[model samples]
Target: MQVKLIFSALTMATLLGACQKAPEPVVTTDAWSPLAQRYVSLVLALGEHDKSYVDAYYGPAEWAEQAKTAGQSAADIATAGSALQAEIRALSATDTMLRLRQHYLITQLTALISHAQTLATGKRASFEQQAQQLYDTLPPQRELASFDTILAELEALVPGEGDLTERVVAYRAGFVIPQDKQQQVFERAIAECQARTLSRIDLPQQERFTLEFVEDKPWSGYNWYQGAAYSLIQINIERPIDISRAVDLGCHEGYPGHHTYNALLEQKLKNELQWVEFSVYPLFSPQSLIAEGTANYGISMAFPGEQKMQFERDVLYPLAGLDAALAAEYAQFLKLMAQLSYAGNEIARLYLNGEIDAATAQSLRQRYLLQSEAEAKQGIRFVDTYGAYVINYNWGKDLVKNYIEQGGSEDERWQRFISLLSTPKLPSSIAWE
Candidate 1:
């Protein structure tokens, strides 16, 4: 009986040992998971380094940090809940879509990584050298023809402090406004913008006008990048809308402008892998050209069938609380002023880039922009830092506007434009009829 019991115990041990599974075969497949993780980490580091560039124009730092946390699904969401709660208490609250996008970016990355890993466990995507070429190619725009004319008109009004270049650059940079009137001018400018747009958009009366104003002056002319929200601030300066100039700036910075277009593209690229490459915002190449062109032209999209008269009489005049008769007279002057500004922007670009001289620069601004010496000086600083991008503002607008006109209906134009905007790759130039 003892021997039999011992035999049964031995047999059971053997069966248990056999039931234990052996280690599976090591599969050598292309895995993108590790690479995705590495890429996200790199992007986050870049954001940290570039934070200073966007400080004034952007919102609080906590919001961007919260977004960074949100973009990592592998981390515990509940653990970061407190940090997000803190961000909500700040001045610029995160919107629902932004929050969702943060997580969506990470989750999408997980899937991409998994797919890539299954195909080849070790291979990863490499960034191309062509990325930096976009920035290097930026050359200034020239408005020599108009600048010559405006110089004569403005020379008598304001004492010519030398030439157009110096005066225009200085004035544009906030040098012209008296210290006391700066805030007043800024406030009134913003108020006028809000009032102008309230009646134009097809929103219900109850849903009308909740325009959120941030300090746009500091970062008004620069490109915005993503960290937390797709854009931390609206670069839209609420200047008294000169119908034409307002439309030009509005299109470049607002609806069809930088903010709107970026938000749209970011939303489309919510996938993790896409965010790693595209959302980081390299300043050069076809990307800026396409982005600038589309945004510069967006004014036409938002105000299709818009007339210059309606812009001034209906929108701009009402916003400033001006009388109809006085408004009409002022509107014409504003239109001329704006066109002059645009033309001067071109001249600034040429002069700063060494294509033109200081004398030529001054001539260009004074003649084209109708600059007081102070204003022309302000414009000079702008052209120096930015280079030829000024041309993009007007040239892009013309290109897109013409394209839309030739393409027939607004919807049709948009359909074609959307296709262009949707690509992962950027085109060097926009095609127009």
Candidate 2:
């Protein structure tokens, strides 16, 4: 009887141990993960809904393809998007890291659905409303008349009989790089930009890019981020290529800008952390605020005030065969004119919401912004196509510059700047105000 009791006790302990062992944690998407499949659904559904929705996708193409094969109708997609958004909203995870990632996915998916609904309904949200919902920030738009002070300042710098616009145009016309020499000058400019960025930010050894000068693009320059630390940089040549644009374009498109931002995120987030959200870049999202702001701010970080002027006069002016004597004057005028940058946002608001007609928008561009007729028309065209995206340039630059410069020393500022470029950050992440 004692022997029987011993055996029974051992069996009971074994049973207790079996009950204590964890029922293997449900992790990894392949093990029937609703979240993973839902994410795949949004990507594919958005792709069908709008051609511009998926900016870059290096994920399993089969997933998107499978969703496309399902052939969900527009109504079906909208419904599914709404349902998934609700699910993500209700979802919770015990792990802190998982919770944050889930939140990011939820926030992005919600925006995707919001955009999809707006697209389907053809109901235009106000510029502020749309920018807030889609990009996660509202621009601090100023009155166009407020820019009179800045324009007056620029007028003094020009000192000409005709309108300030014409004088500024004729003066700037001297700085245009000859068509044949555009490629050579841009190449050197980007090279210097890369060197300067590397001095501060340590990029992946494999990071590299190809530069092309293309025409007829809406924006001045674009960086098409091909995954794995590669980017295709295109410069819009339709606008007269100016020598002053060399450093700005170089820093914006190459080093410490779009290319760097993309590469760092790809390396740190996608590669190391295996976060799938970073794998796809939606063009209209808040990420653009970070991308454009950091990129615009990068120009100054790479080449600060007197240094930029010296670089232009020393390297770019000679390369473009422009008058080096006018570099200083052009620099001052450019600084004064940058204040008028916010004017474009107001024009965009008016044009998009039907407060002003297209012609008036273009006309105002020439008069207030001091753009040439051709340039002004192009500027208005961008506003019509991109809507409140115009705010990304100046607004983004201000936010990033303030954030970076607020840190104590120049080195500390760069550290903050690089940290921004490298991390999985949203506009809200950096908001001080």
Candidate 3:
């Protein structure tokens, strides 16, 4: 009986051992790893040359320190970028995600090299050429006359107009949030946006931001993404604080906009997957297209159709001490204005290409964008500073909207949108169809 028991125990042990799988081999070498490290270092080095080159960096401290002291010229940086591109292209990735990483590196390196060469040579391509090279997509050209129909529609909405621009401005002036109540209104708007976004997306518990109202800035709002899932958002009070902008800025700069986008990339790609290339964001690369596009589209995503108007009417209007009855009219006006968004891009194209002077550009902005003189000048200042970057907002929004809405339920749409945020997708890579 003892011998039989011993044999059974031996048989059981053998069967258990056979069922256990072998220990998986540790992946010690990834061909893309070194190239990714080099890319991060190169991006840091480029930041040394152009103050605006590096938008955000949260990589190794030593790498940044090394870049500051490298003393490489633009030509040298371009050469290095080209070499990196060659190395990246020489390697092929079979895995789906790995292939995406490889393509991302290749396209980004191409933009980096092109920008470096431009800096070194002191010569620039045409506005269209530069847009294509820098942003990886060209904004559709629209004739200025194409906006006349929208302007006429706005004219009927705000009748008895001396000029359509003046009438529209006079109408919207009633919707400005009082200076004293600006902070309160903005806080409420941001909180609502946060709640909506949090319900749909899972973000790091520690991720957060601080808000400040700033003056003398060209742009209306800006998000400065700090590493570690934090951001500093500044709203330019230099212009009138429109009640609509509370939700616009709330969603655009905070919830599902720049702040959320940066946090996800840091959390998912940089921290989780250890993709070092995401550590530094270059301002001029194709990534901005995705960033700005999604940020603008986020306003609509967070509040679809009449949802935004309802929120502003019921919640924000009372908070700002404005008449809520006119909310529907303002909503219609804004929708019409959105149709004319492409006009800004056309005006910028004309101005940058020297087809029109600054004065002409400002005039077109007033006539088309229906801006006050101060606002028109501010718009021109933005165009002067950002150049082809004007296209990123409207064009990028259209691209992202189409991609997210392509055959999905609302839940699936949110999932697709979040997927775009977490992945390394370029403008050219997004499926328009």
Count the clashes in each prediction: 43, 0, 0
The local distance difference test score of each candidate is 0.41, 0.76, 0.84
Two-way lDDT contest, 1 vs 3, winner: 3
Evaluated at residue 227, the lDDT of candidate 1 is: 28
**Residue 321 miss distance in model 3 (angstroms):** 0.5
Residue-level lDDT tens digits of model 3 in 58-124: 7777789999999989899899999989999999788767777887888888888888888889876
Say which prediction, candidate 1 or candidate 2, comes out ahead on lDDT.
2
Tens digits of per-residue lDDT for model 2, 272-388: 766656667877677788899999999999997689889889888888888899889889888888878889998888888889999999989998899999999889777766678
* Poorest 10 consecutive residues by lDDT, candidate 3: 1-10
TM-score of candidate 3 on Cα atoms, chains taken together? 0.92
Candidate maximizing TM-score? 3
**What are the TM-scores, per candidate, against the unseen true structure?**
0.51, 0.87, 0.92
Q: How does model 3 fare in lDDT?
A: 0.84
